[model samples]
Target: MTVENASAPPSTRRPSAERAAALAIQHLLSRQDAQGWWKGDLECNVTSDAEDLLLRQFLDIQDKKTTHAAARYIRGQQREDATWATFHGGPGELSTTIEAYVALRLAGDAPDDPHMAGAAAWIRAHGGIAASRVFTRIWLALFGWWKWDDLPELPPEVIFLPKWFPLDIYHFACWARQIIVPLTIVSAKRPVRPAPFSLNELHTDPRLPNPSRRLAPVNSWDGFFQRLDKALHAYHKVAPRRLRKAAMSRAALWIIERLESDGCWGGIQPQATYSLIALRVLGYQLEHPVMRAGLASLDTFAVWREDGARMIEIAQSPVWDTSLAVCALADAGVNPDHPALVKATDWMLGKQILRRGDWAVRRPGLDPGGWAFEFHNNNNPDLDDTAEVILALRRVQHPDPVRVSAAIRRGVRWSLGMQSGNGAWGAFDVDNNSSLPGKLPFCDFAEVTDPPSADVTAHVVEMLANEGRSADPRTQRGIEWLLTEQEPSGAWFGRWGVNHVYGTGAVVPALIAAGLPAAHPAIRRAVTWLRSVQNDDGGWGEDPRSYLDEDWVGRGTSTASQTAWALLALLAADERESEAVERGIGWITLAQREDGTWDEPHFTGTSFPGDMSLSYHLYRQVFPLMALGRYLRAVQQGQSVCGTSDLPR
Candidate 1:
């Protein structure tokens, strides 16, 4: 590994990094929408596509075109072992395989078809439908393939719980809360559409469906929740008819009030699907206006490919993508007032969510001015997007200076006010670190609550420093929290991106931007840990398995986004000329495709660490450009790399 000579003459540094960044900038520009937003395809698992087919089947609206297209996409995702994994190259997941199998059956594939038969054998060996997650069982119940009574109880009366209660709606994270509220209505109705065919072949034993599993120890939290679920089940039987009716009505109102303007709930697919089914259970016909609008909203989540496959995005990410794109272009030496940058800024400014959303429940006095990840979600603007958007706005010399300034100020105040009790920040809510939501049997699939994470806090700290608030007491506390959270191995746990690489990448720059010297003990330790993990290919990669198994930390096949993350950290720690940085940069440049983009099929983004993962299409382009642009600037400066203050304003 050879390090670049930082003291060499101006044009003698790594020119490939510069060349690759230039080509990447043009590629990204061409992909931008006419409306001035950039959202790459958000690719997740086959469950989104499978659940989509299930929903259409339940509503008697499953058309041949959509069914065949979705089936093609699902078939393409099947692993060599004949099952679907939640992420690329990960192990086969039982529930995912189950959902995919049922969906193919609906597409007219016979059970004995080679693919279908192989999937059923895998499912049975893996404990079959009985061992799948609670949500999958509920989907089966809708088609009368599983008994609803055997599932955990989520009564409509749960809507009546006080906000101060342990399992109240607010205790769940915003995403889970949106789905749960509507699901309570579904659970109460227990309405089942006739089955198109039996799913007996997918079960471990056709005679004894939903075999009972052993209970947890009595004193444990899981045991307590198990008993509580039993109690709720009993209560469901003897409850007064009038009270249940009123409770269901109240829950219906709650779902209706929270539906986004685009007719989706919180700009996610699963939530919208459940909300529609819940309303249909309450007597809303397919021809009703709300149902019509919602069915149309679901259509937008579908991405029809050139090869005639239909894919489903779990959610869209326009605000997140556009903000990062602007920051990358600015770092690559685009003029601050370039029409592309200005147009993106104008579009971002228009997206400032001023109306108070669910986040205001805990922060009633804080003003509402933040950005959401999706195009139309107004009720759940998160701290991560708001901070990144502010950082992006600071890089651009927009035409409406006053407008940008006000938006920045509001964003800063709201972010500061959102700090959790422990002096950190979660993505959507304040101090939403509930312990009970996780123990509930029904929430066994994925994360049910939002909690403070190192990546989110790092972004906030970086944003505050750029806004000249580095010395503010709030920012100082955030810095302290980050230092304390660092692992003995010198990495932070990434709750959003792939494991340790992402967390270290995000934290190193934030700490430096907040005035920590390159020699700071924490910064040096992080740099050392990153250097140790450099892959044999001169890049960095951490598998999604790192979230589950300890040995997989900072280990996996190299990917473009993860490599850029590592490079960003090294460059921020004043190691631009180090061998690790040089080699990492070389790997990224050499890996570039002819189109100025890199092909990364791995899941680098996270929704629920081990259970759900994401492949943000724009991540491959934006992050590498940011890393290379900073390297180019460091070469030009002959010393320190370009920090936020050095960028054009």
Candidate 2:
């Protein structure tokens, strides 16, 4: 589909690189509002669309228009083998396949249809109803397709667990905690609605006692958890009714407390859906203010594609996108007092979360001045976003310098205080390094813990250095951590993006920004890695497979955004006059479309690495502009290709 882009300037007879860079910068500026903000589609996969339909079916509010639209979107994503994948050109994911099948069935697709039959065969061959993730099975259990007793037990009493206790609700990752708290209520209620048709045909060997394979090693953590699960199940039946009721009430209160923004609970669809479901089971009516608001909020996430509608985005990225846009513009030499920057700055300033959130557990007294990725994710002001926002604001000379400094100071203190004891930073929460939950029987998806990551640590360090804190002990330790994390091949593992390319791209610049010399072994290793990964097309790309396997690290079809990342990394590492950097710049100059933007259908940005991949549509435009701008500026100034001339040292 053709998308409108930022308007570029008149194409003059300048160098190809300069012309393309100017065009891209102009186009990006054109896309900004008078208020100085930018937002692009936060596209996920069909699972969201399918889940939306399932939620509608469970509520008995399935509308024909939305169903047909959503079904069309799901159908378009099914592979020839009757399965769906989490990312483009990736292997079929069993959970995605199961969810798509259920959504299609809910949309009135007959199980005997050719596509339906093929999917059924595939599902049964794999493991049928029981082989899916714990979350998937829970969804099926809601429709009477699976037995509640067969699912993992999430008692409402989980909310009562002390914060210090392992496996407590609070101890899980922030997103997981929000999901689990509401789930405890659902699991306790055990409410099952009648399905339009039985999924007997989808089960493997229906004659077997339990067609769903719930396998865990007999003598390990799984066994221990299994035994504990049995004990909990037994306790469920004999427990005092009053206590359970009180726990359910407590869970309901917790869910309602997080109903942020208009009607959203934590600005995520999954949590909102579960919150709605649990509240309904708790006897909230359809017209309840909370329910209506939640249902209305879901509409914001729906995008009507040419094929049909897709419930793709978990949440929007207004703050993240806006800050990145501002930084790119500033890098292009846009006036700091430009109305666009001023308006966007004011808008971003309003979004800083001042109230305490779950992060308060780790730093009980730290003031809240961090920004969330999404507009309404107030309780979870992430470290990455906070650092980026501070960097962006620092670029513009806002009229209210005092306010900006105050906000930046609070954000810095909050981000630094949130750092893990190992001298690195996670996107959200502190020292959230729990690996035990990932080993649970139902957690077949990728790591769910919010652990410290190279990309995040780099951002934090870069922010501190830009603010003239390069020699700060925390900043130095972060740089050291990054050095130790580098792979022997010179690439670092990307925790939030696709793979090594993203990791190296992030770490190199941050290291240089913190006054690490380019000749340093760590910096040279990373620079060597970036050069080695360059493709014949003069661009770079890392396959999504890199998230799952090491062999594919820094290997994939040449992509515009990945190329920009590699170029930026090289430039920051003093590779300005290098042929590799020039070739990369040439590739970017050649790839720019007539509209001044570049095409990147490939999923680049990631959520949970392997579990869920994302495409920040703006990446193709934003990074290239920043990279090209920095390159031209450095060349014209006759200086080294280091980032921002004001070196901290």
Candidate 3:
């Protein structure tokens, strides 16, 4: 919503990308924190605030200030129809609307309030609470608003399953695994807190309650899971008391072990909430250190302002943000030995995971040498962060090259070891794409498995080549995998960013950086794809809806970040001399704000492919700088820029 375009007609003399890039560089340097890192506001849906309020409600720690502030923020996001959309300017989301209404209710809004009525109307019109995701209904079941029997069956005994089993605890992507572990304990305990009021009005047909209990098709796998769930429910009632108690103890221990030093579980709200509630159900007191520390950790997620309104960040982005800032500064010609760069690199060096994590479950015996996406998520370092961090480190001439070299070598080795059999790299786990979760009746959202992705794999490939491993068999295998995965249209599927533009942006530069020449047909085809999708305004754009519908790929109004991705892709494919590149450069300079950052309200990061999205608030500022810096570097070097050399590698 903050983005701006020219109000007047095009000028004869536009600021060149190179000149504008210098202005942007100065703008970025002025915005750095005293601690030598950049942390932009990470904006997500109302669910975070809604969930926080619910967590507070469960803990009975409602404070007047936070409650009202979060309420005001939620109210501000309600649409004309009194519903909430997941991303800005998107259509209403049923689950988001239900949660927002519940949070507002917990904040003391009367049920008959106009906004509440409208939200209820929207919910009832869209198949009511039953139609929402399993996670949503599970939240409701806690407050006696929904029946526990109607929910999916998750036994605490899952924690005791052997790794050789199909649905072992490690089978899930780390985030989901964290959620499930604590949630299984919660499900087994089945604690119900009394609600102040019932939600009768939101139901579609009051006579037909407990929707989740309805039988699924007996012929389908979903139906079989339903039957299995029903059978488990029956066992829940008759299971031996001592065995169930032991299973709960095991689940609690599992959760406690993974809690971060700050007491946040996996550095995400959902896991922390589940951990807190599960422990409480198991008789942990509010005064217990785990409970106290967990409660204190949530305050970090709150973004309170002088306006007395607050928003919740789903998770922190320091590691990801700090690494990107390093690359941007390096590309803009900052001295690698600058105190800012030194401080950042030193901080990064300290964050590497030298100990094995859950990722090693599938990759047993692989040495631990990677970086997490957050400041404290040591239990789950990702391939993306590790690759990007190594790339950023390569750009900096650190005072201690021996240490930096050691980190790079370790990270590259660990990262390569985590690559899938297909030669692509996954984020947190290798070969994590077991299809059983998708077939479950409870899985209503997007893909949850951490499968190999083009964007992540490309970043790894670029990092590998930068480390002078281009001749290695592993590197060759990765290149062959990427070639096989290229789309028919010459674009690769972006499993992490928005869509084709981002995938193409990542792959082209990586292919080039890995020694594929611009003259290669693969590079030529990719360059053609980028040009063909260029917007009339001379930039590139892709909608978040592109994940929902492929038809929308590369077809939205241009934003600073997506345009930067397109421009970087073009520059990588040696298209700096093309008109498409010229116009894209023109668009970036034109969109630059007085503060030196470009406006981008649209989300470009993907969490679960099509379902969950995020807007990294600093992306507009950082990416344009990298794109322009790369363009300038390429023009100076005659053509082409390396993905891992600089420009947000």
Candidate 1: the clashing residue pairs are: none
Lowest summed lDDT over 10 consecutive residues: which window, candidate 1?
1-10
Q: What is the Cα-based TM-score of model 1?
A: 0.98
What does the lDDT come to for candidate 1?
Answer: 0.90
| Model 3, C-alpha of 192: deviation from truth (Å) | 0.7
Report lDDT (CA) for all predictions.
0.90, 0.83, 0.84
Q: How far off is residue 459 in model 2, in Å?
A: 0.2
Model 3, 1-649: lDDT tens digits are: 3233422232421345656777787877777777666788888889989999998898889899999999999999898878998887778999999999999999999989999998999999999988888889888999998988888788888888898787887777888888888888888888888988888888998887665455767998878888888899999999899988999998888888888898798788878888999999999999999899899999988888678889998888888888898888787677878777888888889999999889888888899999998768889999999998898888777789999989988998899899898888888898888888666655667675788888898999988888788888888888998998888888888887888888988888888888898888888888888888988776677887888797897788788888888888788777877777777777787788766778787888777776778888888888989888877777777767756643332
Any runs in candidate 3 off by more than 4 Å, and if so which? 1-15, 212-216, 645-649
| Clashing residue pair totals per candidate (backbone < 3 A) | 0, 3, 0
Question: Taking the tens digit of each residue's C-alpha lDDT, what string does model 1 give over 1-649?
Answer: 2222323332433777778988999998998888889999999999999999999999888899999999999999999999999899899999999999999999999999999999999999989899999999999999999998889889889889998898899899999999998899898889899988999998889999878878888899998889888898899889899999999899888888887889888889999999999999999999998899889999999999999999999999999999999988888888888888888999999999999999988899999989999989889999999999999999888778998999999999999999999999999999899999888878988899999999999999999999888899999999999999999999999999997999999999899889998999999999999999988778889999999999999998888899999988888889987888877887888788878999899999999988899999999999998888888888778665525745534
Give all TM-scores, in the order shown: 0.98, 0.95, 0.96
| Predicted structure with the largest TM-score when compared to the true one | 1
Say which candidate scores most in lDDT: 1
Q: What C-alpha RMSD separates each model from the true structure?
A: 2.4, 3.5, 2.4
Model 3: per-residue Cα lDDT at residue 538: 69
Q: Which ten-residue region of model 3 has the weakest summed lDDT?
A: 6-15
| lDDT tens per residue, model 2, 1-649 | 1212111221321277788877987899889866557988887778888889989888888899999988988998888888898887778888889999999999999999999999989988888877788888889999888888887776888778788888777667888878778888888989999888888887776666255445467688887777777788888888789889999999898888888867887778888888889999999999999889988888888778865555568778889899988888887778888888999999999999999998898889888889998868888899999998998998888899899899999999898889899999998989888877776555666566798999999889989988888898988899899999999999888887777888888888888888988888988988888889888777888888887787788988777778878877888887887778777777777778999999887888888887888888888888888888787776777565555426221
Model 2 steric clash pairs: 6-27, 7-27, 130-212
